[model samples]
Target: MRRVGREEPRAGRAVLPLSLTLVSGILDAVSFLGLGHVFVANMTGNVVVLGMALGGSPDFSTPGCLVALAGFVAGTVVSGRLAGAVPRPPVPALVVESVLLVAATAVAFAGLTPGRRFAAIGLLGLAMGLRTASIRLAGVSDITTTVITSTLAALGARSALAGGDGAGWGRRLGAVLLLLAGAGGGAWLILRWGPGVALVAATGIQAATGGAYAYLSRRRP
Candidate 1:
């Protein structure tokens, strides 16, 4: 476990990445169900939808998928440049993620109606991309927050039932459950209130995650 702020890594102290994962699930759900038939955080789904669009599926849009993929990649590029600029514990990265998520929430509500849905998708995708890239450099294990394919694989491989040591199962299980809970909550919010409320909720959680990290870093040092 890599230290985020010079403190010794403790067991069960995975609130930060779990929160980010929850945000990802929420944003992805909002984007898919509310904004458009597209995924902002889950690029794999976008790729599949893009393929469907190319195959003449009327339900998907090539332009929307392209925008999201481009935005996500661009965010990764931006974060790559900032990776060297930030100090230890990835505080700068968290700041950047928080700001991006807030901006995404604002953009989603800034008249991004059905006509301008692609713009909102791009913004949210960019934020997720930035977050994924920055966190990659953080050296955290079993908390990618963006995708769980690897996490699922790890869980299966490390499970005692699979003839291996049951290490890292807790993180993997927590991530899976958090993502599920987030997606369910986002869907409920979208059905009851609107996408705006879901985005606002995600932004609040992201802000809290960053704030908590900042406080912990300060107290540890």
Candidate 2:
């Protein structure tokens, strides 16, 4: 149990959210560059693009991103429904996110010719949103999974006021760094090879995370 004014146990359980954030970054980068300058993982960026599109910006498209956002909402709905039935964050999250990944894998496999940009973008966005909502409901604080601004802000505040102990600053810092790593690597993979490679990598990472959570749950019992 957490005190009203105190931070939760960041050293152990809190690490779970960061892992999902890393997954978010990778998928975001892949969707951004490969999916026609749209974002599946980071809705903030997608919303920004949406606004620009409405403002008649040449670089962004209004309809394309709206589709991604809709898919994301659908994905979130799916995740929320799963949560309602299970009522456990970690296990339910794993189940929902793994299903999203299966959807993503199916899209990737279906679009293996490397040309169905819209299909990939839509599927990727839905998968990411579903996975993100699961993490958000896990009751993590200081990390939003899909959004980095608050995470960075929290890291700064904690690192500065760390005083003597720093109160789990390492984990927060690790979250930021892991997100960067995911984005950078995802971008690199997409640019060098193709969306297929990045999708594969993202799928593998999430699958492993699900496996880890399941293993930990078993051990706890």
Which candidate number would show the highest lDDT if scored against the true structure?
1
| TM-score leader | 1
Score candidate 2 by lDDT.
Answer: 0.70
- lDDT (10s digit) by residue, model 2, range 122-192: 67767766766765665545566777877676676667465444666776778888889999998998888
Which segments of model 2 are wrong by more than 4 Å? 1-14, 112-116, 161-165
C-alpha positional error of residue 78 in candidate 1 after TM-score superposition, expressed in Å: 1.3
Alpha carbon lDDT of each predicted model: 0.79, 0.70
lDDT by residue (tens digit), candidate 1, 89-196? 356667777787677677767766755687788788788888787677656445789888888998998899899998878888989998988899999999998888
Q: Could you tell me the lDDT of residue 165 within candidate 2?
A: 49
Per-model TM values vs. the true structure: 0.90, 0.83
Displacement of residue 169 (Cα, Å) in model 2 is 1.7
